[model samples]
Target: MIHVLVTQAGHLEETSKQCCKMSETTSKHTSALCTMQSLHLVLLVVLTIFVYYVSKPHVTEVQPMNRFDVTNVSYTVSMAQPTDSIQRTAVSERTYVMVMSQKRSGSSFMGELFNQNPTVFFMFEPLRSLTSLAMKKTSFSFETAVHNTLNSIFKCELTHVPVSGWVVKKTEVSTCFNAFEMQNNSVLRQICSKYDLTGNQMFLNISSTLCKRRSHFAFKTIRITDLAHLKPFFVNDEFNIKVIHLVRDPRAVMNSRHLLHEENLDFIRRKGTHADEVKDLCQNMKVNIAYGQHIPDWLVGRYKLVRYEDLAEKPFQVTSDIYNYLGWILPQEVNTWILRNTDHDDDKAYSRTRDSRKTAQAWRKTMPFPDVLNIQNKCQDVMKLLGYVQFESRQSMRDAKSSCIPFNGYLNHI
Candidate 1:
């Protein structure tokens, strides 16, 4: 079974990183006090040929009402029983999903989780589509011609490549980075093995399902949450598309980020405009629910908002939820399998001892108080609206604010 979890977080990441960059120059006192870090993460995200839109502000989390036709939602949520006469959805056919987000956070983690399913396959981020688009816009280059065909297929661009025996999928590169994820992504090989697929062959893994029909495949380019406006690319009814949205507390997100250096904005293009930070974050949560608010929502109270803390503390359970969402009963062997597959148990095992827990408070200890306030204040409205009280109680704030990133203040020597 090919299970899918779509996490859309393009600009949310770009914004925070840019915050680090601008904060360095914007604040006079913190410039030297705060050792300016390098810009690897930000650069990695920007230079990515996949090109999602974080340059814009006030990123609109797509509400169901924004686009989904009720009938289309029905198609997405429709389930086919193994014995049902309603015709089994074609196999050997492929579906696609784009793992999107600003840099950091857990988008990559989810992608890895989904990839683990034996039934799915992927191209981490071939930059196939973006390269293709650029090639067409300019003149086709040898480097991009192969992918330019891929980009054309995906963008449904001006050029039309004949659909032979394959599909072109366009998704974010973070999804392809195997550093945190693993899966039996052999459908590509299987398809190529089973069929004499041609260069013109194309289909899309819009639902992230493996091509049971196995054929040579490639995902062109997908819309990043920053480039969220492009979501309509998959919003129609003809092809069944499933979307997953992942959100973590902004606090802990900030903690993991402090370990990283700030990136440069020259690489990022400011496309969208901003209105309110907190409101946008809150609405993003709502948008996640609105699109896939099936019976038990995925975030809170039906919605499954995987707390990064919980995910790290209890990876199996978190993944079980993910597996379940993808409509699969996780194999009982998952625990032993994970142990054998990777060194993830260490990241998951809960740290014992008060000292260990205190060490986890790196964000609070290292981030200057004002930076914390800036992060909280920026997202404070969402905090309240989502039933997460503002940053009043430090202990609860630390515990609850484990989803997103926070601001970094002056550094205390480790």
Candidate 2:
């Protein structure tokens, strides 16, 4: 009986040991499963965070504010974000003005109107350098170059100029001086020296000075003909852009081209024959003028079509109206300059320096009757659209009974 009891006790001890081993094995398995689950959960969280970051909208560098008072103004610009390809945020408030016109269409004269304003930082034919740069960088489109350059100028972000994607030549900064005729301007000279851009430094670092002052920025471009091409600029909230679409009578434009060609026969020869040149010019004028006919709803207030004739015929009134349209208070200095410039009588053959008032009617006298007829015939539709009266015959002028209905479609604002 004692031997049987001892054997039973040994069996019980063996069972207990087996139970302990099983429990240790189960705990190890459970711990391994828990660790794997925790690892998976951590991985899932990391992936979620990465996806959220990747899906977020892209935000471009914020445009710097004007140095002047912008306490009351707020600008919101939408740009596609790089990461998620979504547009977010608003552009800052900086006024940008562009004079859109064709060559020899009184763009220079209109540009001068803005140039005379002390508050305006005017850049004339800024596209010339851009075009040159675009040619070198074949990968970059001309439109893109223009867009970037204009934005940089308006934002006073000079360092953004000669951007690798748009500009191939870093030394193109000298072009600005040539465009603005700043070589003799003392202020520009001082600024250049301040930036250490004098002498061998052809590239400009304009940020040190130009960006420090706040002013309304303006530029004139004859390079762009289609209004649609400027859509990017118009929609960009970074700039409160106003467009002045200047148009001249086709007859006047033709005559001016003819006269200019006559003066520079070599240039005319290089371009083409007189007829071909005039035909091309007239076609370009027609296409560009027609762009104004159907102004987009978004552009109604932002775009203004101004006839060179109207501006010349009624300088003060038209200018005042322009100022009002642009939401600018015509400064006393501007008024004084206008008065002083327009008061005099101009009698020059072909001088951009003459009193602009005389320039309005000079086209009528300068263009021969037959040539005027040709131009009128070529541009009849546009001429009529722009309120230019065409007499069927010279006799109709003497009769004073010719049908007279001025088509002032875009001029309703004036």
Candidate 3:
């Protein structure tokens, strides 16, 4: 009986030992499972964070406006989505210059004088975009469009520029225009790829950055008709504005316009006769010259008039005078560009390269005597103001040795 009771006790002890071993194995398996689940949760959180940042858009900072007091001008602000928006950075002071001229008056060549300078951020016919937009939108105010586009670009916020696709292709952004050659431009390409962008937006980032880096800002425009239209721009204390009003002989202008067959694009839409066109051109010039002559307090020391004939005659002197007037150094590269461009001949209508002296006088030889007489008759007042002499006869007009531009013209002093 004692042996049987001892056997039962041994069996119970073995059973209890087996139960303890099973409990230890189960606890170990549960702990390993919990650790694997925790690792997976941590990985999921890390992946979510990475995705949030990778998909985020780039942001650029720009300066906010203190005040843009344009009278009777209604400017529109850009309404791009926040994802594509550019924020304002700190405002840095810069010199703003506008090269205002009539088309075919050597404005393209004149603009290049500034465009070649690395120090100057140059824009070509930006208002031409405004002119296009104004045509489509009847509500558009010319003054408003001018101020809006200029204000945005001048401030280095390019998102709001009224740029059309045609302007993009023809102007400085692609192959670039009037200034800042973008043809085969590596910086522009890199910016586009880095931002994963296409079309005009590709230029937006690069242009704004470039604009800020430069000390001087110059734009050439033929859209603004009256000097009084820019009264608001001149008064703004935020900018140090200078105006270079470029004029040319009306006869030469008419001759160039005829070459392009651009009579339809003339500012005067009246009878469309050659005489009427010259009449309209002279009237605009007369008004602007009068304003410059009786300069206002705001425009004093700020407005300058340049004749295409004078610039063509004395490229270096006029350019130097212009740089001096603006308190800027005449870069050696500008001189080199002047040397190369002035002596060469290019058949392209908008070619900057030309024999400038020959070009200035080409109208005399190219235009018929009847056409010359008609222009002279209509633009006599303007010719007198700008120092162009009227020809007595066809023989005198044909005389290459006897020049029509007087040696003692108004531009001689400049």
Instruction: Give the candidate number with the greatest TM-score.
Output: 3
Residue-by-residue lDDT tens digits, candidate 3, 1-414: 434544554565565455555656678766565555555555655655666677678685643321111121112223222223332222335678899888789998998888777677677777765655565666878788777888887787776776552136453434233133342222343344344334465456555655555667888888777888778877877678899999998988888999997544436322334546677778888888886668888798888888888889889988998998899999997899899989869788888889999999998887899999898898898788788889979899889999887545336333
Cα displacement (angstroms), candidate 1, residue 217, comes to 10
How would the candidate models be sorted by TM-score, starting from the highest? 3, 2, 1
lDDT value, residue 53 of candidate 2: 71
Q: Where is the poorest 10-residue window by lDDT in model 3?
A: 65-74
User: Which runs of model 1 end up more than 4 angstroms from their true locations?
Assistant: 1-100, 126-223, 226-235, 262-267, 271-305, 332-337, 340-362, 385-390, 393-414
Which one wins on lDDT? 3
lDDT of 3 at 200: 62
Ranking by lDDT: 3, 2, 1
Span of 10 residues, lowest total lDDT, candidate 2: 78-87
Q: Residue 107's C-alpha lDDT in candidate 3?
A: 92
Question: All candidates' lDDT scores?
Answer: 0.38, 0.58, 0.70
lDDT for model 3: 0.70
